[model samples]
Target: MDLQDQLKNLFPDHEPEESTDKIDAKPSYWLQDDPIICKYEKRKGKPITILEGYNGADSDLKKLAKDLKTFLGVGGSVKKETIIIQGDFRDKIMAFLKDNGFTVKRVGG
Candidate 1:
């Protein structure tokens, strides 16, 4: 007999319980009321994008940073709650954040 058949024969009176794990598997992150600042700067003649003003757990912010980097196919790092992207991706990053339910504020050129 198959595994399911064996299980049914052994626990004929047992009722299958609904899985609650799905409810807890949803990804959750802290949401802030203030918009996250997206700024552009030139360091050593190379353009870099900076995201700051996020008031949340550093781990969540780091996950966000990694997601952004992977989505944009670029390199970045997180320091002191600030996300530093290697290129000037202010527009793209802001759009991605907004699509993911985040408030983004563009600051400076």
Candidate 2:
């Protein structure tokens, strides 16, 4: 099943949180639905990863982008509930979230 479908089946009451894109030394941890992390297609093959969800808002998502970028020392952004980071940071991403108290699982790779 697709990420969204799996997430819906996993948590029916899942809600969209908010991200402000601020640079916080301590990022928030979230056990959210499926997050879409794919290499960005544009920018001359820059290793960009895009993370999207069924829920989550611009502010919270922006926060995610900022935190991940700083953590991985890469570039990224957040828009329309999507957080895009420039790099294949799947392993680091999952570990970072978990280390900060967020439950996570690798959906695909």
Best by TM-score: 1
- Clashes within 3 Å, all models in order: 0, 9
**What local lDDT does model 2 show for residue 100?**
66
lDDT of 2 at 45: 69
lDDT of candidate model 2 versus the reference? 0.65
What 10-residue stretch in candidate 1 is worst by lDDT?
20-29
What's the lDDT for residue 86 in model 1? Answer: 96
TM per prediction: 0.74, 0.54
lDDT by residue for model 2 (1-109), tens: 8998988899999985788687875666444555444433445866666655525555666666777798899877776666777777877876776676555545553
Clashing pairs in 1: none
- Minimum summed lDDT over a 10-residue window in model 2 is located at 33-42
Local distance difference test values of all predictions, in order: 0.89, 0.65
